[model samples]
Target: MTTIEQASGAEPRGGGVEHVDVLVVGAGVSGIDAAYHLRERFPERSFAVLDAQEDRGGTWWTHRYPGVRSDSDLFTYGYRFKPWTGPSIAAGEEILAYLDEVIAENGLAGYIRYQHRVTAARWSSGDHRWTVEVTRGDTGEQLRLTTDFLWMCQGYYNHARPYQPRWEGMDRFAGVVVHPQRWPVDLDYSGKRVVVIGSGSTASTLIPAIAEKAAHVTMLQRSPSYYFAPPTTHELAVTLRQLDIPEEWTHEILRRQYISQYHWLARMSFEAPDELHTFLIESMRPLLPEGFDVEKHFTPRYRPWQQRIAIVPDGDLFAAVREGRVSIVTDTIAEFTEKGIRVGSGEEIPADVVVTATGFNLSLLGDVAFTVDGEPVDFPQRVTWRGVMIAGVPNMAYMFGYFRHSWTLRVDLVSDLVCRLLETMQAKGAATVVPTLRPEDDGMQLRPWSDPENFNAGYVLRSQHILFKQGDREPWTHMLEHEQEREILPNADLDDGSLVYR
Candidate 1:
């Protein structure tokens, strides 16, 4: 963590105000990565990280719902600069703790201002800077700040809006209704009948955790989701490291495990759908009830990876079902009744508590309003430059994680690349840099990274397009292949026709 010095001028000058080399919004995994790299590249320039929340860890801290855990393994989710020192697959608290450690270790606390929410940002072509308006959450005060470069790290989930499906008689229901994103901390479910709606990772994880105390737990799925179970710890890697294999070699082997799984899933999604379904069923057979039908509870109408798949921590969800502590109901939710919910299949299930884990509304680019020289820029109408920068937007970038691989995999690469780009620009005394897609490059028609229809709440659904776009050639096409990213992203031709410099 480097020391901070105040800019020479603090007051606003005409439309342009206090100027910084870069202004980063949101202090989550992406924002932190961006700031760290920016400092490494240009330590002389001024940069700041602003977050709406009072603390860091963006979504991890925002979401306090019970049974929260990462679907991806922690080994790959952590930043490259910092190694995650915990079990392979970590719980929500563990990940949050890691973020805290990174912030403290880097001494980024002084560089970040919490409770400052950016309302809008407009680029001035004449001045070659952005005038940003921010609202102070504590005092409802407004302040103006300007920067030459704007990096949007705020992710897609709407922090305020919880996705609760409209049921005809929801208001009349007697039981407490909650959304997983806004689970009340003081609420207790001891000896109560709880029904978790939706079949994604959240509900799957919630069922098993809640079943321990809840009298009966039921997972109501409007549609089935593919579920798979794998050990949280890798036995082979553990054995190899114990046998005196180098730790780096062990790490590489563990990373390869993730790559293999990612490729298998991609192939299943693009080529062999039936085989994928069969493989999942076969893997889950040992954990299912003696006479339960796999098709009824696990088979989804959509193709593999069409929607995000739910992963259990070593078959905990299936074990809970097998023990009769948790049950699954594959039926349409008809309406809310006085005591519970009524399904379209004409069954009324009684519950003391109901949790709606339906999904999230995608809010791209942190839902921040942007304008260029007082003219607003329509984001969706613009082309994505390498899936990171937007065409026609200068000195601006957005951090999007890998869709098919771990979130940190691409994030780390993007951070490194950004640092190098800054370094190159500074060396040449360039004021602004932006990447643009060639109009003749028909990359938009290429296969999308993930299924467009696959829906999940928060960051998962928002940045799905990143997967198919070429981050680099060959093995680096996927985020997990960091060696390729190290080679291509940091040292790539900065003067390429795609990037504009001034």
Candidate 2:
């Protein structure tokens, strides 16, 4: 295990120690973006990015699942500073490579410490610093670090363990059962009947990809989910390049495409439920089996966007179904049999492999224990300050985004605001900063900040409500149009309500 020490030049002990101006946890997209911005804003202050995994690209590197493609398009998912170079919406390896490229191009590797899992953090009111504790993955050594600020980029989806539905006789089943996250590389599915459980994006993507090689692929879902077919890339790219529009204008047009699609879907889910259902059925009609009931196989009971809508490129999943390569089983799994799985309809489908794309367990705040001067911090007991920052937590911010919109939209905005806030702190000679919302701030009453019905779990509960609340208010809510974000967050007030400076 090679350990690279920072230039502080202190003698290393068993339980190493270090201090810096800032500590950004989870070296994923959010963490890396935050660290880069901090360096740009505060070139003199030292900052470090720490991640539990030995490698970079948090989920991209850790998730070895089959057919792991992003739900969002590459054009919107890639960072503003770095343009993605892939043709079709890139796969997992492509995204990871893009992240690595960004890190290398920006020379961010020197500031990152891999295999450091942060366990706890405490705010010191007297010293105005966060005392962070972490475990070293290599040596199992506990280490302590201090920094003026703590930025959490650990996305909501990364920490929680993948959820697998419990079925009787699962252990007795002779065939292999695999969770997408733990997909066995050498397990051959060729010429074997495969049953994939769930209707989320992961399952949808996997069914199509695996159907091409497997003898038979079956998608089993307790209830159907809204699936939309979007173009692989925005048409704005072609038009802008053809028309020779300025890069800024092309970017603006692409931004509009993203915003329009998000709002159109959001509005359909919120207002025109019946119309949305009709639109979905019409779009899916050509793909369903001749006698298949569209309502039974495609219609969902929940409102649109109740859970996230899964996106497939040009109806690839539906096309797979149409080709007789994949089959849809709209029934709950009652139990597992030695030969296959039994459905609630008393029908047993023979399968040689079972893939559980069930869902995930939700955990907030990186599951990191927080304390103030050694007193435990209860997150549920406290109200959110602005949907991003929590009250009484000094110099800390969470990377939260909208469930209805692409996550990068909100993450980018939050990152921009964080940079501006840091610059403001430097200008004011502030050692610590915390946002305090007014007691009667109408922002809290805007919408269901989090969705209780959609049980995919993790940071969604806390962040959902927070993002919704911010969307209804100013400064907190930037217009979905990208140019607006570029302007608003950069100049937004750091002292809006009460950002106490010490």
Candidate 3:
């Protein structure tokens, strides 16, 4: 109900610095969620959503590879406040449209500023505010802004540079080698032999989409990853629609159902991994060819749920393989020959196009330079406060979502907790709030941002040294399950010894 001007406390000083109550970074799903909560809870607070990308839909806008879609169901991936009337599994464009609807319905478009990238954030305790430096992607101009609170929703991975390892003779390959993250729109693969490297979601999705156009498609992987083939539409959702139930009712019902199912699956991974693994592999047997080596190509060395289980809607990937449009090769790459890639066994797979669906590098806070009172932030040495705020950092919260459940589930939870904290700050007449270590917590053992034992994805393992650490006790540790945090975050005490207010 409040315009940016009405919510702002300070006027622009000679066009040098503008002031807002809160500044949200990134216009993606998480940032949008944060914007909604802030406006709803503190309608009088001025805030702006800044994204480096040219448009909205952070990761959705950045990734344009063929067949890019959500591996998680839309029922939970969609916002808790919105109703998703589409199928459970949605394509990239569909997801973007969903985001567009949210912005239009909530009048959030006015608050979002595209092509505005925050490069540096410096907190000054003396002023009780943060001075942020931004670069305009549209124009080569720099801008400065000040805010009382900062909310970071930038995704974890680096969008510009993807992780592509060099092969023995990569330079000698005659075929065009492309990373999925940077797929070229004009690069044609039609009627050409395509070899996709790595067996993650990108590889699985690409093979099916490009298989029909390409002469032959092959999935080359160092090791297999677990895959699940859920139906595009949930039967309950379909039934609810047929019964004339409202879309909002259907969305809420399906969201809770998926959350419970995901919780159970995560539990099974920890309690009975072998049994769960067997079920996942067996489920794929009917979709694959009878003589296909499921154990060799579909089975994974690690347990299911350790890494994300790639969701293949209605077994499209398997259908492509079963119909002889695609093939899977499980072997390490020996080198890249002039024609194509050669495996460790000395077998050469000829291809006209080599798609390195390898993965991406992790970026800490969007690679922004952050300082607390002019001192650079050393993230590894700092402990996280409930995975939301970094300890000793004043009035800042970042959104790191759940790995076991849909990411937006955590976004909504974190939004609730943050809005409540803001309300507490208002009631107490505080200028700044920071998390600090109490005397009793001085000797607690510190752990990595993500426990390798719990979730050791390639990007996470590579970025541990640059990420914030967690502690052994509550209020300091993070990466909790949705079920657990759903109960703990709302009731968390603001007067706990962890937070210091002034």
Candidate 4:
């Protein structure tokens, strides 16, 4: 940590805001990555990571529902800089342990200030700084901080408020209703009938974990979602460890393997969707019970990779269904009955507990109110510069990760880009660097943050209006291709007309 430097015409000492070279808005995977890169790349600079939670592990720490685990493999989900020694599909506690190890080993614990929530940020071009308002969760005390650059890595969703649908008779139901986001820590489900709504990853993970303990668990969804059940452990990792290969080598090898596999799947989804869809559906057949209606329960109306496919470890969800521990009901909820829920098919399922695992509410910039030079930032009207920086916002970068592959892949790339941008500013002796629309880009068409035709996850579609827009030209678009970006971002031209420095 560096001593606070008072800016011109600003308060000093106790009543003044602390200053740093970079202020990271979250202590999650992205923030930690940013901190590590900053320390390694620019050791002379001062930076601090702030997170609203009492501890780190943003999503992993926030979500405490039973059977919560990564929907994607850990090899890719884990940071590229770290080697994940755990299973490919890891539990919440395992991930937290891994994060703790990273923080402890890197001596990054000192840079992170937990329980500090950023409520608003105001960028001052004249002062060449950003004044941020923070609320301390522990003491409920208000604080202020100023930084030369703002790094928004707080994640894409609102942790406190999850997407929960309201049924007409939810209040009339006699049993307890729960949303997985706010799962009760002490709630008992043993020997009780549980009905889980939604067939997304959360529901899939929770169903098998609670099925054995609960008397009966039913998955009720209006539409089906695709599922992929791979072995929890990758054979290559096993072989590498057996051969006494270095952990770094194994991590890189496995990370590349997963990325290549996902790339193939992504290309197949776009170029040969029917064949890819057939391959996915056929893959699930052998794992399911004999004569199981795969079309009714597992078939999604959209093409493969349109939305994220849930990863089921060793086909556990299917095994539970095979053993009759779990039942799948595909129908709209007519209403909540006193005992359970009534379906559109005129069938009433009995349940003592109901869990809504539908989805989450997308939050833009951690829902932090942002202003640039006394003007509020209307994100929906602004365009993204390479999916990292929002146009017209000076010295700020937000981490919006991938939908087809691991998010941290992009996080690593963005961290590199941001560092490079800072170096460019230093080299030019510029105080600010903002993405501005060039003369040629005057008539460029703006699209939604994400293309619905390619990726239309329900949560994204619902909150698309709040997300920043993407442009049609190069450097103005948010390209989701990790392979292409691997080559493009490293050599991206900082002197390009898309960015203006002052």
Candidate 1, which segments miss by more than 4 Å at Cα? 1-17, 240-252, 436-493
1-502: candidate 2 lDDT, tens digit per residue: 2233572322333445667777889888788888778766677878888888889987787777777888876656777666554533668898888888888888788888898888999899898888788888888877788778888888766344766668898998999999887777898998999999888888998888888889999999899988888666556677667787776566556765766777787677657978887887788787666776778888887767777788887788988888889888899888999999999999999999999988765557678888988888766545554456776678898886556566677777788887777778888998988765555564454334453653333335534532323324553332233344546655666776657787
RMSD of each: 4.5, 4.0, 2.3, 2.6
How many clashes (backbone N, Cα, C below 3 Å) per candidate? 1, 6, 0, 0
Q: What C-alpha lDDT does candidate 1 achieve relative to the native structure?
A: 0.75
Write the residue-wise lDDT of candidate 3 on 214-300 in tens digits. Answer: 999999999999999999999999999999999999999999999998999989999999999999999999999989999999888
Model 1 per-residue lDDT tens digits across residues 1-502: 1112334223345544455778889999889888777766667777888899988888887888877888887767877677655667777899888888888887677778788898899887778888788887877877778888888898767788856678899999999998988889998999999999989888887788889999999999888888878787767767876798766666666776776777678667658888988898889888989988778888888777666667887999999999999999999989999999999988999999998988765566766888877777776456556556766778887787865567777887777766777777778888877665555554444333433454343445555543224323221123333444546665667676677778
- lDDT at position 444, candidate 1: 42
Candidate 3 matches the true fold with a TM-score of 0.98
Better of 1 and 2 by lDDT: 1
lDDT of 4 by residue, 1-502 (tens): 2222333222343455587888889989889889889888988888888999989999999999988999888888899888988888999999999999999988888888889899999999999989898888887888888888999999987898899999979998999999988999999999999999999899999999999899999999999998888899999999999999999899889999999998898888889999998898999999888999998888898999899988899999999999999999999999998989999999999999999998999998989999998999999999999988999999998877787788888889989999999999999999999999999999999999888897999999999999889988888998568888988889999998999999
| TM values, all candidates | 0.88, 0.88, 0.98, 0.97
> Which 10-residue window of candidate 3 scores lowest in summed lDDT?
1-10
User: Clashes in model 2: which pairs?
Assistant: 362-457, 362-458, 363-458, 449-464, 449-465, 450-465
CA RMSD (A), model 1: 4.5
Residue 255 in model 4: shift from native, Å? 1.1
| Residue clash pairs of candidate 4 | none
In terms of lDDT, the best-performing candidate is 3
Whole-model lDDT, candidate 2? 0.74
The prediction achieving the highest TM-score against the true structure is 3
